[model samples]
Target: MQCSFRQLKEKSLSTEVTQMQWNPKMDLLALANTQGEVWLHRLNWQRVWTLSPPTGTTEGQGVTGLAWRPDGQVLGVGYQNGQVVLCDVEKAEVLHTSTLSHPVSCMTWQEAEDKHRVTSAPVHVDQSSSPVSSQATPQDTAADFLPRLTPLPKGYSATDKANSEEEIVEDNKRLSSQTRLNILVVGDEAGSIYLLAYGLFSMGQLAPEEHPQAKGGRLLSVTLSSDLQCLSAVVQHQASADTSQPEHTICLTTYNTSLLATRSQELATLAMKYGQVATILGYMENTLRSMSEAWEDILLEMDNKLAKFAETIDNKDPDWQVSDEFLQLLMWGKASPELQSFLLNTLTEKGLKKLGLSIDNSYSNIEKLVLNHLQRAGQALLFHLSELKGLSLWYDKYGMLGLNTQAVQEAWSCAGSFMLKTNELLQ
Candidate 1:
């Protein structure tokens, strides 16, 4: 059979294109070039945005692979320099970065079916699981009761980016909640493959050299089947063991990934809960950081006042008990000469009251942030982590997924400790 092909559109670029992938859910195309730069283009070949390699990277370190996240929202660009960067599709801003011990070879991203479209009964989607061990029901979903966090002021709010706000919002609506279970797989030349859950969390790594199939071969590329039942890898083996002039042979290898397909729904819900955990963690961090910055200013003011008082007291307190003198003043409404001079002259009544009020207000703000935001966020985080730990309890099912029950329990306990610490701070 013969088929005729026609090129619809083409564009010339100064750099040679080394790799390209069409977005599965959109008309956008992501291209990596010899210059180690990644570029996005519209359906008509109109240039969208360009992403340069990391600073200080050598010019010879070109892009190795480019994979679009399942929803076509984030693009994963791998480089010969052993770095992988997940970039937002809209403005080419980086979302996350990871490094590999070996240079990257190829990458692929896949997602399980959407969970919201499933007609399961509504479980508390916020906290979907528990280690006490209940099978995932059809209704298992994230039941986030936590308040929606205010979006942080973003760094890339350019005028050109305004046109894609709706698309970006839609992408976030899909990704922020983790409605679909997705994985980003990156293979390196050292016969090692790395996996990222939702393109953000490290899931696990596969060292093919440990397996017989790899017998002294380097990985060339890797792919996951559409149904998530199997993973395929291409390896190049040295047919002749001559170090200076070796003959190479390519081979195909496959691994069973059926659990990924069978447990897709439950894992999707697990990811949803984990997403909740991440969101709450971020909110708590921001709230605590702001409170800390505010307290820093108050600390400086207090330090200034304390410095003067300390200088005055240094000359007077050789053997005197200042605590006893302060207690005597409190009961009798009169202070000794040195103490009276410091209180009435150095610190006037109005000035002392103002200082106390300032400190009180700062403490009040800290209490509000802790009680209203930080503590609650920690609780929400614990709820989600407990659900994740519950998933770990199904050892037969989740064991291969590389989630350690002990690790999950440790994370849960840490969240609890964080909540207690916040309460203690307020007190």
Candidate 2:
């Protein structure tokens, strides 16, 4: 679960790696550096294709943040000039550019759309089984259900006014929307997260107001370390209620490998519209199943990937070799109480199969074979019995193959005769 970023390859890009954005669709990484130079690097182990800057010139622009549009055509670059530039990766051209309020710290797409109005037709619940009062009962109208406030007290103090003002402050609340926009999030050295809704084409033809550079996203101060190394934000996944097209979720990671964020809150909100309680539980269960399966599949794929990587590198490379830590992570941990109960209830069946023995007759046959081997090896079949003679009642408790004294004694007498013959052969 814990992994450190290993440097695969370092290119002496006229400047240090200021910001890097991995293409959403391809293995192309767009890098921007302090020298105001942007380079496109196609990442593959056997071959690396690099597209250098057309002309090396320090335009006094320091690449602070980099982002790739969802469709993979345009790359969003944030610079020290407080400008957000959309660059075409294939043609190596800048498509669109705009300046922001503050020096661009962080930029990302706004995954959630504000839904101020309801569209779908409402379903009326039957009054008989519903928690609300029956229609037959005369009660206060639905207007009463609406949130109402009491009039302010006479001569309210300034402190009370300030407290009421602070209580109404809304923090980073976004409405739900079906339209998908490529989130370009940038975090600056000043520890501010700036999100920009870019790649306007992804949401189909957009009006001038919907343009990426024009419709900038909300700015919030997010949690970051003291050195301001990395910033991460959780985004909303696309809406899926409409059956025409499947929704998409994006995963964003920093160059330092510190933070990872997903855009899926809208999906969670959409699930609650039909029935909040039932939908939320189902969503949680499905999420757990997805996470468990994803980790399992990652380990399964790692087998082949590690093998191929190991073939090229020295076996001693810690990353190439499968570590015991990772192996333990792949193994199943302590079973739940319910699962443990089921296992114990069927212990004989499970244990027998695991040991490669049959439950019904094979186990008994194996036990008999062991006893016979001991008898044939001239081993004494000593029975520690109480001194009370004619203890016929005790024979059944010992499981001596008979309850009656005569049957028990007869079996032992025959076993004794067989032992003598076996001893003679040994002599």
Candidate 3:
């Protein structure tokens, strides 16, 4: 049977579009223009959001590629400056960012079909050909271990805290794992292809050496086969030998990616593991930053109450040595002369109590945030990345992922150390 085509609504654009892609899951369209601007529009041509180039973007570093996450919730915008920003579709909020060493030229988002493969993450450290463990594969959002991360109270965002609630981006809207295996493949001018899972995980990279012809050539496009069996790219360059006509040389190359086929299932499963870790790491970072801000606020407020005392100590010795003024008041229930002046010479008793209560409450909030949100996120990251490191044990099976065991180990240790140091600080 022959398929018939119908003409959809035709609306002309006001600018020269460099690249455009339609969201598979929605009627929205994503477009990039020569001015390095990105636009999201509905089927009726109503604009949803527009993303301008990041500040300090150098001239000529316009957008080079655009791709929508398979779920259409995020858009990966690649630039000529080797930067890729994953943005939320609803508000164009920059959810995450990554950079490559070379200029980004093309990108493709691919989703893997099940092919009767089991759906679960590879969790064990032992040698196995399959997801050999009983662990749940939301990467343990279903497992007995790795506690789930709770949203931070107040969702403290340093960048958007000053904005109104309606304008602030939601923390829950950031990138996370999908049920199916989805990979965002990016290619750059230096003949390299980056395989990223969930727009966050660095699954692997095909280096310039893999395609010598693309070393100095302009990469047109790149893609991974649906079966995960082949990697392909198109490149074009000037043919110096035929200079009279300004001849151009175009090359179409496909390399047999053995690992993609042999370990396709493992790759899909590891994606979940990496994605869970990435999401938790972002949460931990936000929690840490919020804690820092909370401490700074307390310090600033205390300065108003104790600035003179602090200055007196600074003048007495280079190293600040606290006088017995506060100690005497706390222990003897009687204030020193200076302490009395700081407490307003007699009784601003109510004001003093309120300030003390405010500080105490602030500290309690920060402590609870850390003990609840931050610690859970850090432990989850450590647990999942450790599983990733274990996959490194069978390098022959997971070698293409380029998982640096040493780096993962260091991260695992750092997460553990951070938890310990934070506990020490709290205690």
On TM-score, the candidate that comes out on top is: 3
What is each predicted model's overall lDDT from 0 to 1? Answer: 0.68, 0.39, 0.72
Candidate 2 lDDT, 125-153, residue by residue in tens: 23363221223222212123322211121
lDDT of 1 by residue, 1-427 (tens): 2457766776788989999999988989888888788888889888899998888866537899889887788899888878888888877777667889888888989775443132222243334563212343345443445443333322211222333333321123235534456788888878887877676666667896556676667878788876678888888888765566558878898988876677665555555555455556656777778688657645655655545555666556576544555557658998778777877788888878876776677666666666655766676677678767777776765655666899999988888887788778877
- In model 3, what is the error at residue 263, expressed in angstroms? 0.8
Top lDDT model: 3
What residue runs in model 2 are displaced by over 4 Å at the alpha carbon? Answer: 1-14, 45-60, 110-179, 186-195, 199-427
All candidates: TM-score: 0.69, 0.29, 0.79
Q: Model 1 has how many clashing residue pairs?
A: 10
Scored by lDDT, model 3 comes in at 0.72
* lDDT of prediction 2: 0.39
Evaluate model 3: give its TM-score: 0.79
- Candidate 3 regions exceeding 4 Å error are 1-15, 56-61, 116-120, 124-143, 155-177, 305-340, 344-347, 399-401
Clashes of each: 10, 19, 0
Model 3: per-residue Cα lDDT over 1-427, one tens digit each: 2558777788888888998899989999999998889989998899999999877866745889999887888899999889988998877888778889988989998876555143446553344423322233323333577555655556432322433344311234353335566678999888788998767778788787877878778788998787667888998777777467557778899988756666665776666665566667777788888888887666666655665566644355555433345545667899756666667853378877876876786687688777877777767767777777777666776655666788888988988898898788688
lDDT of 3 at 372: 73
| lDDT, residue 174, model 1 | 37
